[model samples]
Target: MTGLLPDNDLLVQFSQLFQQRTSLSNMQAHWQQYHWKETIKLGFSNHKHEDWKYTSLDRLLQYRFNYAQKLKISKQQCDCLALPLDSHRLVFLNGRFIASLSDNIYESYQVSSLVEQKNIPVAVHAEVFLHLTESLAQESLLIRLAAGKKSNKPLYLLHISSGQTDNQNKNIINSSYYRHHLLIEENAKIQVIEHFVSLNNQSHFTCARLTISLGDNAQLTHYKLAFENQHSYHFSHNDLILGNHAYAHSDSFLLGANLTRHHTSAQLNGKGSYISINSLLLPFREEICDSRTYLEHNKGHCHSQQLHKTIVYNNGKAVFDGILKVAPHAVRTDGKITNNNLLLSKQAEVNTKPRLEIYTDDVKCSHGATVGYIDIEQVSYLRSRGISKTKAKQMIIFAFAAELTESLKNKIIHQQVVTRITKRLKRIDI
Candidate 1:
């Protein structure tokens, strides 16, 4: 629950579980500083909440979740996930960072736990879940790239969850909470790749948040891959802020998860800053995926581009809401937004909303959204080329997704993303 729910039972259970684990004066006092007491009183968001209106949490609220604890899994099993093997890598299992699995690289970047560096910059729109993660997670991963420093390799992160139901703890569901902070100082450059998966391929809920700050002349490139099992629920938020001459490129691949909601907000606050966000949401077999993105141009000479593509099949549903806001003084702001979706079956559907709110007359902004089935003309062309009907459909779907995937700069990561999407498409019912 986001602490906005009417049900006090979960909050009670969570409090009770905390009390039962340790003495009130001991570890129990640790959870209080998170400001959860006030947030819980505010309660869970309903259909009336504008941002959450399209996606319902009723299906997820039926289960009771327990806070995840640290556990060790086999090395062979870790390899099975095919996680990226970057030189500078950090691994977190169930929300707990594993120092043993993390790379001890130094001299190029600064990596510390939130416990040591408590001064984290709060983005503009801090949500209840961000505070909730702070109250529960004792330690969070914090990475800071030294100003004017450039890294030869990308920073890799593996966030995996694996476990069965917590039967011993009153049958509580196993849910994990994780928080990460990234700082790119002035004139610094860095690349980060994050892979989220269910290590055991089991059902669970994951709440995650990533805060990014880019200083003047800094550049950060981020790629996120979410491949949780369809039986699981996952929610995440990305808060990114850019400074003068800063640049950002964010690419996301949403493949699985029974119920997934992702909120991304980016603010270009300094002149000459630029941002490009591209996403591919491919959900199959009754999964529900929702992506909400907001881009704000607060300064002049800034540009933003967003291209979102989704393929929903087997009675699955996909929702996308994108907003581009330009400040009154943000002259010469340029933005482009496009959302295209393909529904394979009659039962599959999508809801898309793309808007532009321009406060100044000196901005150039445009948006377009389309939802429909595959073009019969293209399918027929492929079929005439001796391709099977099923294979032809698959080809067209891949073509639609390739438009965004081809924009990726890292070949290794690009291959991995393409392979995952192809594998998932192969398993979909024709």
Candidate 2:
């Protein structure tokens, strides 16, 4: 195929699947068709693209992944992967929602599987994967919190990917697509956690999209946990919009997948809005992790803060690209971004870029990045205190990551995050 359209095996497979699926509204079908054609015209990005300079899709595009078939999984299987928190759970297996496995919500909240709700705008992006998701997604979810109400418990959305087993007892490579939307009305508050995991060590591909809208004075706390297998590939996009005096806090933990990319964009469209985003990435062995964030200050008296940390080991690589832009009318805008990376091996690599674009002279903005190895001085000090070299190194690594984990206000979630980080850090050599 000359582009991503003519004879691409992945597109061909998804086209067939799309034709066989039913229950799509006329408007939805038209929307999908439009995006599919746009995807073919735009094609995929390469290293030459400014936004994709550090991450390449060559490895991910080489595989011919079939659509993931529905599989039967017990609640026990999901429990093993879930965090110990009291929350209402919504489960999805292989991109299809399982109503039997989900918990019922109260009357104060509105939840449904349909995507044809009014006032929900479709995603428009130049990226190929996003367009593909818009074209091929077979499952969708919409959650709305009523005005002046707050959720008593958090909402947990768990997405699990599992491949089919062949006659030779090997797993088949497959793909799944999903889309989710969350809406918080004025004076409402809610907390949400989106967890991604795998049932087995199967090679698969997952593409997901999430769009969040906060009305005036709304509050939201969001968390995303990605713990897929090392043989899988994952791509996700998040778009957030904040209204007047709205507040939003988002935390992302990336610790798995052979190749992964997360793109997030936040817009402060109303005055006095605030947003804070934090991310932790651990790429070990030959894995690659890429994260990108774009913040737009469209109104005055808005503020934003971002902190990103990455730890690389062996021959792994990590990338971070962040940009904050203030419009001409957005006076009194405050924005700050910091990125720190730790290299555990000489072969490990990190690529970081934090930029600011300001059109208003009254705004305050700063950006910085740092990349270095563990301090030998701290290790020596720990050794003199009768700690073993391996233990000392582990302690330092934990402390480096604790900055983000300790920020979690929920005790159960804080402990769970710390435990996962400790378990992953055990693989590093002293």
Best by TM-score: 2
Candidate 2 off by > 4 Å: 1-23, 122-126, 167-172
What is the C-alpha lDDT profile of model 1 across 1-430, one tens digit per residue? 4424465454655554344332123332444354466446544576667666767777766666776667887766676775655558778898888877777774587887655434565545555555555556545777889899999988888888865744555445677877788988999999988789997656787878888999999999999899888788888888889999999999989888989888788999999999999889987877889987888899999999999999999878899988899999999999999999999989897999999999998788999999989889998999999999989998888888889888788888888888888888878776
Model 1 residue 379 distance off true place after TM-score fit, in angstroms:
1.4
Task: Report lDDT per candidate.
Answer: 0.80, 0.84
Q: TM per model?
A: 0.91, 0.94
Question: Can you write out model 2's per-residue Cα lDDT over 263-335, one digit (the tens) per residue?
Answer: 8888999999999988999999889999889888999999999999999999899999998989899999999
Task: Tell me the lDDT of candidate 1.
Answer: 0.80
lDDT, model 1, position 350: 91
Output the lDDT of residue 273, model 2.
98
Off by over 4 Å in 1: 1-38, 116-119, 165-171
What's the alpha carbon RMSD for model 1?
3.2
Position 207, candidate 1: lDDT: 78
Q: Candidate 2 — which pairs collide? A: none
Q: Lowest-lDDT window of 10 residues in candidate 2? A: 1-10
